[model samples]
Target: MRIKRPRIRQKIIFTLERQLVKGAHYQLLLLAALIGLISIVGGILVMPSGEPTSTFGESVWWAFLRLSDPGYLGDDQGNWRRFISTLITVAGYVVFLGSLVAVITTWMNRKIRHLEQGLTPVTANNHILILGWSNRTIHIAAEIFQSVGRIRRFLEKYDAKKLQLIILSEEVSSFQMQELKDHPMIGTRAHEIVLRTGLAIDREHLRRVDSLNASCVIVPSLAYGRKELISPDIETIKCLLSLNAEAQAQNNQDLPYVVAEIQDENKINAARRSYTGPLEVIGSNTIISRLMAQNIRHPGLSAVYNEILSQVDDNNLFSQVFPELTGQPMGRLKRAFTRAVVLGIVKSEGEHFSPQLNLPDDYLLEDDVLLVLLAKNSTDLVWRKDRISTDYAPMPFLGMLPVEELENRINILVLGWNEHVPALIRELCTYEDEKYFIRLVGLRPIAEREKELAFLSENGDRVVVENVVADFIRESEIRKLAAETFDHILMVSSDRMEEEEEADARTMVGYVLLEEVLEKASKRPSVLLELSDPSNESLIRRFQSEVIISPMVLSHLLAGIALQRELNSIYNELFTVGGAEIIFRNLPEYGLSSGKKRFDELESLASAHGETILGVYLDRPDASGNHLLLNPAKSHEIGLSDNDRFVVLTTFY
Candidate 1:
């Protein structure tokens, strides 16, 4: 019986020891109890010789004071009493105070480490939410700041006090986060940004940012460092699914607007299936391909697109509803607004809205149609009641003379292979009565590229694509391609490269090699280069080439949509096919002499031809090295040359 009792007591003692080891708080509590017990027992056992026998409560009180402060032992009388007092005081210092200090220090360090790791949740409302981190994020952040600056400069009633942006990303380290905040463009707005380190697909992380209360969520494609993911689009879809699941769990019917950048156009439908909300998918590769094709066909048009896309200064695209000018003829509508150049009328057709750019002179506006105009600012577009006149003569609809097609087939050389290559080939095939001979030069095998582009071959017979297996960065291969034989040289950045700097460096090498090869030839082809990073723009500009920085352009679009939601529709109308697009038409075709003419006269002549003139581009740069001017004043006189071209908006058909 005695042996069994000892074993049971040992088991109980082991359980307490395990508990004390498991929890710091429990250990602290046990230490406090031990101090109290020692003080109470000591107080009862000892007393001064001259004093009356101390009561239990009085002795306890005396022991507590002595334990707390060693000075309480100075008046002790007997050796045993003094020894007990000193022992209590020493126990207080060694056991109670020491453990308390150590526990507090450990707790504080743990809290600080957690915060430094960016695990703390953010509690902000109406803030912009940015998911994922990449090289383009810095540009996106810059564009957003620029938009806010524009609002602060123009709009007086806007509440510009608290501008907040919460970024959620798993790959962003604490040092990297600090560096981003301290960046020149971002550092100025550091107080407004909150960064958290967590995967976007994690529900707990999403809850931390209060996703339901966000004004907008921008999901950028994942950075190239994420090797586990097959592609950025897959990661984006996962995030969307997680976000939707969270929203559904909370019964939130009104989810925030989500703008996601997708790399592959085919994955758009899959992304849409994940989120049952207002989603805008920007196809980065598709849009870049379209822009490249457009720039190739029409020289110096990239500048106009850049100006309209970036709202850096005042020149931008604005849509206004002028009830006063409603039901007026299209011709008179132009003169009614003195400040803005009325581009077209936006009318709804079924579920989609279309822009009518080449309306007849006497066409009447029935319902309230949105007027698209290019102006410095919205305030510039004011109703000029005095300028409005109903008695204007109806002008005949003028049509541009068909351009004479060359007898020879057009040859285009593509220097790299990417997702955009197929789209570019399809776009090039769309030109009427034109035979396109496209040669794809890259490290990829010809069979693989052909398999990927098998669908295009079945649909179109106008484009003949041939692939050459060779690295364009090699000077010998560049020389072998016969650079002088092609009409256009298109350099595409390699998407397979994981690092943006490495991809851009390869592009630079290719361009340099191509330029060296072209120098020895008699013919100089028009060069159009695609860049992933805008920082490389200056390096590539030394060559006579038109540079299209797709990442920067996409970032601007994302930022613009976040700031003004209506911009999504405007951009869709402008960039897509079968819509009004900006083009450079020959000035002489409009019947204007080669001399100085008022912008209003040119505007009237353009309106007569069913076109809206934005500005002009000299074939050669002026004294200030300026080639393209957009949104010029109406009264400003511009000298025209037979070589110059008119920048105008006209229908493709």
Candidate 2:
């Protein structure tokens, strides 16, 4: 007994009904033409004027004149002429009627715009608005949505509402639109949701979601190089200026906060001009390069960072530690803030930032910021005076685990170009162990890097880059150029795209080579990539230890984050401190074999010793092969095999 399906007639009716609501204007225009034609023709044929009927062409010509500028002859006109003209002879009247219709349409549009000021029915007023189109648009939108989702979930338990989001993009093409439609759990918040549109700088589409009225706006960096009419820097400058002009017209110039990405670091001044009131740059790859270069030189640094940056849990992967969290050193901060953890802190003195600092001592947190780890945005920072008295768990500290404990020596092979390579490698050289182990693999040395390299080597630091002369894009050359010469492999884009097809070709070759190496090598060297586009980040993650940073998109993230009060201080403390380093170590004395949890350990341990536990990583189950989940809760227990990274707030210098 199979159920019968709807017939073709029924299906067509259903489809038409669905389309009619949205496409009514098209249908109505057709109807108006038909009705207007019929009224004129029918009235003309039936008129009782005894004169012979005119041809169709004659009727059309007369109708046009009457509708547009009916010229009146003397009142005592001939009967045939008067009869033919009287019924339709009002030019001003028709014009007035059409103008009335247009006015009504404009009124309706204004009303819609007014309603949009409140919120999208789904996202509400507290949602996020992301603008512009770029490769990193997808990645930033995804991460932001996930971040907001986690924040929403946390709020729902307490307030029953969540942060939401809406994204605006340029109508690039059908393929990009198709890509947007395919994503399901973007925002990841209960009330947190996302709506994507091809509408760009147009105010009408922005009015659809109340762009200015939203709590925040995020314009992410372009993880990949996007084409522009002018130089990317100049185009960024001009577009930002125009955007600022629009926002100003609404008296919202300094009212709403804005976040945007800039391609060239040089164009940052223009981004400043575009920002209303307060603005932030979310993914500032330029500044982040110093950190990336430092992290890459040190193995397992990626693991520690993935925890801080990821938006995968209810507790923020990274958070700020409050001043009241006293006596505990950096290592203990991880567990004190709910089940959340601490990586490090910017000190008030701007001097020392050691995870393994002296505890029971005044924890020197950055006066402006405290870098921490939580599943979501923040945890309840109220000092539990009651809990402080009731649950003070103290553990006897054995001794300090020296920084030299981990295997740091690494030989890295990097492909492609990056503007920040010189500064990046320079920071890496500060790590003594990593400094001795690196061999830069590429063709000619970048001129900027040459000065830094010579200086480091002159200072007795073993900074050597064995330039294996070969094209990384050529398949055969990769095998011929000492493929197994390094401990880790990285690929980056050196310059922006001069031509689209050429860049794509280069990326494809690199991707294949990476995959090929993965297939054959027994020890799949840690592979990290700075890809052409942020969207490509997803593609490469399928391998391992891979991250693609889009400078264009990240510039926006940086802008947004910069807008966040106290967050910039935290970021500066976390990254700018010369000696500050984050590491993952094995410590089961705090519980289970492997995986997160250790959120509560820092207090007593730090009370005895000055060690700060930044964060912990576990082979936690996730779509990305046992994801290293960040900022687990206090209740969340861990096994023995887990890697616990204690950030010793000390400089590599």
> Which candidate has the top score in TM-score?
1
C-alpha lDDT (0 to 100) for residue 222 of candidate 2: 41
Model 1: per-residue Cα lDDT over 1-653, one tens digit each: 44544578889899779967665688778777877898788877775433533677778777888777778778777888788878888987876678778867776887787786678888776678898777667677777776643344323323435567788867546576676676666675765667788888888889977887776799888545545546788888998999999999999998877889888788989998889887878877777777877787776677787677643564676665677676887778777767778877776555345666656567777677778788776577775776676567745667654443545677899999777898887666666567778899998877889887886755466778888999999998888899889999999888778888898899999998888888888889899887787778888666788888777778888777666555667777677775677777786688766889888778788877777788888777877787776767777788878888988887656
Q: Rate residue 285 of model 1 by lDDT.
A: 71
Q: How many clashing pairs in candidate 2?
A: 79
Winning model by lDDT? 1
Q: How large an RMSD does model 1 have?
A: 4.6
Give per-residue lDDT, candidate 1, residue 496. 78
